[model samples]
Target: MSEPEEDLQEEQRDSTKKKKKKEKRSGKKKKQKEEREQEEAQQQVDEEEEERSECVVLRGIFKLGKKSHDVLLTRTRLTWIPITPETPTGEPCVLQPGVVLTAGRVRGEGEAAASGRPAVGGAVLGVALFCCRRRGRRLEEDTLHLHNASAEHTQTWYNTLKELLAGFSSRPRYLKVFINPSSHKKEAVHIYREHVAPLFKMADIRIDITVTERKGHALSVMKECKLDEYDGVVCVGGDGSVAELCHALVLRAQLDADSPEKPVKPVLPLGIIPAGSTDVVSCSVHGVRDPVTATLHIVLGHLQQVDMCSFLSQGQLVRFGFSAMFGFGGRSLARAEKKRWMPSSRRREYALVKTLARLRPEDCQLSFQPAKTSTGNLFEHRDEDQDVKQDPESEGEESWTTNQGLYLSISIMSIPCLSPHAPRGLAPNTSLANGSAALIAVGNTSRSEFIKHLKRYSSSSGQFSFSFVETHAVSAVRIRPSSLINWSEEESEEEGDSKTTPIIQSEGAAFPWNIDGELVEIANEVLVRVHPRLITLYGEEVDEAESTVSCSCI
Candidate 1:
């Protein structure tokens, strides 16, 4: 072979080898890129799953020697994550296992302010007969001070196996409960006995129940009961029961006092366990009136305090969880009561029939004092004393002043919503603990006008100004007909002329009045004052913002 042929062949082999090496490098790079992308995708999926499961519920009891503590909790709402083992100041030892829990709030200073000690949430973690501290440890010695973190050297054990519960959720500090059967409804007692008792077994509470025997018993009961005993009271019957309950609860505070010398406290709380013909409160508070879910809230120990108002007639007080109203429409309450003897299913139609027949302009006297310039203005004591030296005779006319008008009905409430059926409720500026009342009256004539007012009251669609409302706080009220007031001539005649209509005399006679949901014949005048923390309510201490916004207050 020639020298030229050998050189050409060698060059051809070198070029082919270079091409093969380049192809191998490209394939390897492609494979690496694909593997990198796969890993990134898997990592992204894992990250998403972790975020969804970021919530951790740790429940267990800490045992120091022979003593054990119970810890019941739902979730911790915090602004920052905590990493230290130190016990937060003012916060109780919630790390202990087997402790019963309820959703609660904790206030402390700085980090300590948010600690969960002095839990106001009305959650009962079973009965704690005693809480003894360790022999040498000085922790929990002062409830007002911040608790120190348990020393690592101190001996302690946690029991997490049996006490660790899963599937916990967040909840409120107050709840609404209804007792429907109350003897008048066949299933009210059964429902309470079978279901309500179990839920109560899991919470802390002071309950007020109204049992109706005759038809309007619930209404009369609601008109007379004290609202301070509960965070929320519920009705277990049908629509009429709810309506009557709401009607009585919606009456504005006529006087500050439940009793003359002692001012009344906040109106009781409201809730419903719908066993009635119609469950408006239930449907409104929650979209559905599921008994099991309602029972679950009690079991889970959720609580919230709501606002209410009081109405005064003569000198007696009537409290409203919703509104204080009058007019011929209030007769619907009496009619609904009379129809209770019929089947629950038929009560609605019968009530409508009675309402249509009895619809009329109920002539009443309405006197109102406009809402003060500010809430501070409600309390005369809180104002500047410009008249401390004024003549006593000049004060007489001001002290005995009164306003009067004619009306088909009058209603004032604490909440903006009533019965879940009516929208516009108590004055928006009112609060459960603010120590004031809303005064509303309807003077419209004819059934249509009365209904229009009723619709406006119930729909809550109005954007009313201060001019449309009369809000005030007073110690007494006087209600009487501006014109000729008539008692049922038929009912009065049966007792003969000697009865003299049992007139609500300005001097000596007792007038029938509603307190909370209970009814009673009270003395002609109701003297009211603010009740200072009369009953302990287990829930968040109402904040200024919430008190100013919605009517749900504690």
Candidate 2:
């Protein structure tokens, strides 16, 4: 804490940063060198190389650093040809969407321009055009000043430049956004005010904001709201609100379709901004929990189709989301939901302790058909391969595996459930829209062993290595509680002529069903069906090799 010590620590931190920067620079240089060598050996160009040979719309001198270049804006990429008599225009410096940072028009002061420079300044006087180009990890501003140009010519070139940049997106100018005020941390409004609104304004994206006042408010709004007026639906809240909006949107789309047999679903993408305690869906998709980055993705108009799982009880749709859980996972969420009014920091701990103390696994019968990828060591036992043959109802694709046992938890995750509780994600290998859901059945085990397994979730360790844990990639699953059913009978001999009825009550607790962190009614049986690519989201598809690093906006 002394001044000298503080100075030393600060100097050390700065030195470390410098070293990291130097290492990154060296790595980038090496990669570039290898890339150039490979290209030369193969005599091949990049994918968009041929596109640059098309008609050059605009051409002029532009300044990059101290040097000038004759730039050409083609249909696909930008080419900067250095103006020099000695050196040939060897692969004209090419730039696509990835390297171009900020592309806009410049005004005021004039900069000296040589023939090699592209027209940077485009409007009225000076170099009328400017763009920040990426140099390794950093961005460098490059301006072009037209040495001699008329006002009309400048305006024309600027418009053309804008058009070129706009080609990256489908050009969605308008969108409808819903903000849930009572969601996790109560910061959706503040998040929008501080980050989302400003970036959206700059992008020239018109957003109609609606701050929700009550629960189930978004559901009603989506039911009655116009579907074709905007480019996409933006939900800013926790998993509950986002899931609610999705449910309502999907229902409405089906309702409004002309043909009930085969409905025409809406292709409107949904954008999720994480402004809640648990943004599992958003985090799972984007690989981060930042609100601005999510908003930018919407503005960039990235499209991804997401799978949806519909939970139905007695043929009526209860709810639908990307993920759901039964038994202990459900009970734990229910206990947690009670203390949602408290701070997220305290609520999680409170929920965990309270739920564990009263935790009791319920005996239930599960019937599910295994997905193609689920036939592994776990299915080696094959308890009910004969059960499938005996049951006439479960014919063809309905190869149900019936099992009865006390289970701690049964989790059905369509998307990877990522949160502080499960940092590496609950179902880490679950696909985003792979036409399947991961069914994890945690059999009854000792409290200490269960806690030990739970602790492993916080780290990148083997949480599924427990002997009691079993997982299957299933397309459809049905859970039937052994002791959840109820029966009532009326006595024939009543007092005088009146008939009396007696209600039969079960002594045990029912396993709570958790659907997107919200509890459904205590039902004896529940059915889940996966719908592949049911709705489009403003995120990329779940690639098999999804990188942990921040993905570039493509």
Candidate 3:
């Protein structure tokens, strides 16, 4: 073969190899571009899926005010879009966001139709939607009306909305209500009828109400009534009424379980409507002592589990309470209970003044088991090592710390007991369902100093900043008064014998203890044990409470 022919063939082979490499590179680039586009499309679909609406129940056209609008209903929300006049039959011009459905209502007829007024824009059928509108910490009712020419569409929308609302499992369907007509100015019945009852009706919750006629009437009713028929229990009264209900519910649960040693959580949630002189539980739970706010919380099915304290005296269950006070508080309440003929406000003021005038310390022995998890104590005047001590009696068990002193007042609270007089709560360091209680001991101080400590509760902070005040987060506490000593019998020896024995009596001497605003006289030592998340209350958890109008009595 010729050298020129071989070189030409080689050049041809080189050209063919270069052309094949170029084609291969071009195919690779094209495939990479297609893969990128597919990935982008998949990502877009995933984003849309994340933002997708819940199952759509109904969709149609309705007249809102003077213009036509497109409405969409789903399991979670109710959305509406405005239709421009130029695009009457086309898609909506503006797509507005939907309103989340809470405790709302839907009716087949609108206000205009009910009032015999002509429908706006000459529409025939109408539907009204009543929804909850939140304004800061308050909730208000709002209504939206939609008019359509087709009755079948309006009726379908109403039915679909009703079914969706009914599907919410958290909201209560039936409630057993107890109204203490004698609670605080004798207006509990009126408050329930005027403010709370209407809201319950609006939410379509069935209620069986019992107007309490006496002090222990509600407790008796709670003991005998069948709680299984109701979804929740509601009390309309002061803290005393609420405390009664809490005790009754817990006692009933223990009895039903046949385990008095191990108490179980109540089967139902409790709702409080503030119609009392001092609505501490309501204020502490709802952040405000407003009846409407509490009612709205119940209607919305907001659940907050709270810790409760079981008070046992001499190995017998005294009661279940959220907060308790001994020493000065108990004495003041004892005085106030004796003055029932006076008006409630006047009686409280008189009690406060009289108690302050005769402020004396009680010699008592305090023992408590500190919580395992350290919830930092508020205004701790001593070091942690000094506060905790090993119990010699229980060698390997939990250590128990004992303190014996003359204390002006001893307070134990599982929840922040917010009230008009004490906006920061009697125990400001405590929280709901923390498995611990705030044990505050105010050591014996001067009258001025004690008054200053008491008045600081109305302020924001520094209520526990006093040197004499000490706070601890404890799981259990035992309080025994050292002053409960009485001489029962004394025997005189014969002439010249000169021998006499004195008999010390411990029983039959009852001391007043202010427990959840109810005065209970208990004998012997009281053991308070905290149960974590023992009961469910209808309200949201609050970290802080805003101050209300302070009382002038203090």
Candidate 4:
């Protein structure tokens, strides 16, 4: 064959390969185009569905700042889109219903109305939306102004917003307020007037205020007051005030049912305004200890049903509380109570220093009933014998676990007690309404090691990772403290030292217990049982909290 014939055959093969490669590339581009079109179509359908779910109550043209935009009001949100020449409907600025506090007409405004822009066609008519803007853990009030040229248009928007806000049934119309005048810094009244009253007035909520004169004044009011007229009860004080109100409300329900054994749930919800030093309950529920945030939670009608613990001594009702601490906690509080003349802050510091200087463990016996594997409603009151007979399959299993020894501190909490000192809470494993409580037992250890364990609560995690600490989820607990005189004498005799006296030496003396920040004295064993969803509070469950404050006493 000739060289020219071989070159012609090679050229023919190269042309055929190039044609097949070009066809494959074209087919790939066509398939990519088809996939892109399908994705776009699905996104459009999804947007349409979301719009349909949120029915638009009103839509019109309104000016935000200096720009003319299309505003839309829905049942759950208010949104506005910038209308520019390039993009007629630009990105929307959405305002959820939870953030909006109220709306009203704004007349004769300067910067608040269109950034000092004069009305183009007629007199300036504007509507202002009052909203609570959340920045991290704090909530600040802000205003969004929308102006239009027509007066009737602005009036229509204002009226519609007012009617929509009124339709929220969860929000309270009337509240029975009890203000304790002797809270931290004696500023409970001032905090309410400065930060809380104006918001309630703006929301048109009628409040019947009563300034408490004594420690149990709120309880007295709760006993005789008409619960039907008020939508809810508001406590403007510390955790003690909150605990007192809770006990009063629960007792009232029991009396109304004419059965102390079978107490019913409270008919009205309770709202707490933080005015105390350590606002543990307020911080746990609202995730912050700010008064405005608490009031906003009440105004927004956020509901959280919390578990409650009932303390009984000698088979008699003592009180209903959310959390309790014995040993060091009780002794410190008792010492603080003795120095009532001192300032609250100074009193707490003095008590803490004194207690730490004389840190000692108490001899106590603890018995707790572990929670069942499958969670059930704990609200229904049942006898222990009845529960045991009903579950015959678990006859061999032990229901209660007992532990007796010396302990520096023991804490039982139904809700995670979140505060500034403890960001993750003293009981980080427990939840708000989980039908169980967290039993934390700290065994005897050196003072330095114990302080290290206490200081770990403020960190992010690992607060209960110490060798002397133990945690369990329980439904009921019995705490019995040994006689102080008897235990001390026996120890001194064993050591052959007659000069050693008991830390708290008294005959027939009562044991001090810190329950929800209140000091209670009991001479015998106390049984604490958890009741799930016993009372509804005006706040949402908090998963995490941010703390900017720390304790320096350690």
Give the number of the best model, judged by TM-score: 3
lDDT per residue for candidate 2 within 293-351, as digits (tens), equals 57756765656777788887777777778888886667667666677677776776776
lDDT of each: 0.39, 0.66, 0.77, 0.77
User: Where does candidate 3 clash, by residue pair?
Assistant: none
Per-residue lDDT of 57-94 in model 3, one digit per residue for the tens?
A: 67888887887777777655666777754466775465
Candidate 3 residues lying further than 4 Å off, grouped into runs, are: 1-53, 84-98, 103-124, 382-389, 393-396, 485-507, 550-553
Per-residue lDDT of model 4, residues 1-554, tens digit only: 89999999999999999998999999999999999999999999998877874778889998878878788877656777777555347645553221232322111120011111223465657876666666666655556778887878887888787777777677789999999988988899999999999888766789999999998899988889989999999999999999999999999988888878965789899999999888889988889989988887777677889999999998899999999998889888988988989988788889888776667777677777776642432222222211122222223654666666667888899999998888888887888899889888777777788888877777547767777777778888888776632222122333322212224445666777899999898888888988998998988778766687655346
Q: What is the lDDT of residue 461 in candidate 2?
A: 57
Report the alpha-carbon TM-score of model 2 versus the true structure. Answer: 0.72
Candidates 1 and 3: which is better by TM-score? 3
Runs of candidate 4 with Cα error greater than 4 angstroms are: 1-53, 86-124, 373-398, 484-507, 550-553
Please, what are the lDDT tens digits per residue for candidate 1 over residues 1-554?
99999999999999999999999898999899999999999999998766544444443343323344333222322121222244557554434232212223222211111112221244322211111111211111111121123432111111121122112223222334445554335677787667665444333333445566665666565556554444455566654565555544543222324444333443553345656533433443433434444444333333444433334444344433334344433444445445667774476557555554444443333333333323432223211211122223222333432434333444454333323333323344454444345544434345444444444534444423222223354322334543333323123324323211222224443333323323334433333222312221222221111111233211
State each model's C-alpha RMSD to the native.
22.4, 18.9, 11.8, 12.1
Off by over 4 Å in 2: 1-55, 64-69, 79-98, 101-153, 165-171, 258-264, 372-391, 485-511, 541-554
Candidate 4: Cα lDDT at 365: 73
When 1 and 3 are scored with lDDT, the better candidate is 3
Steric clash count of candidate 4: 0
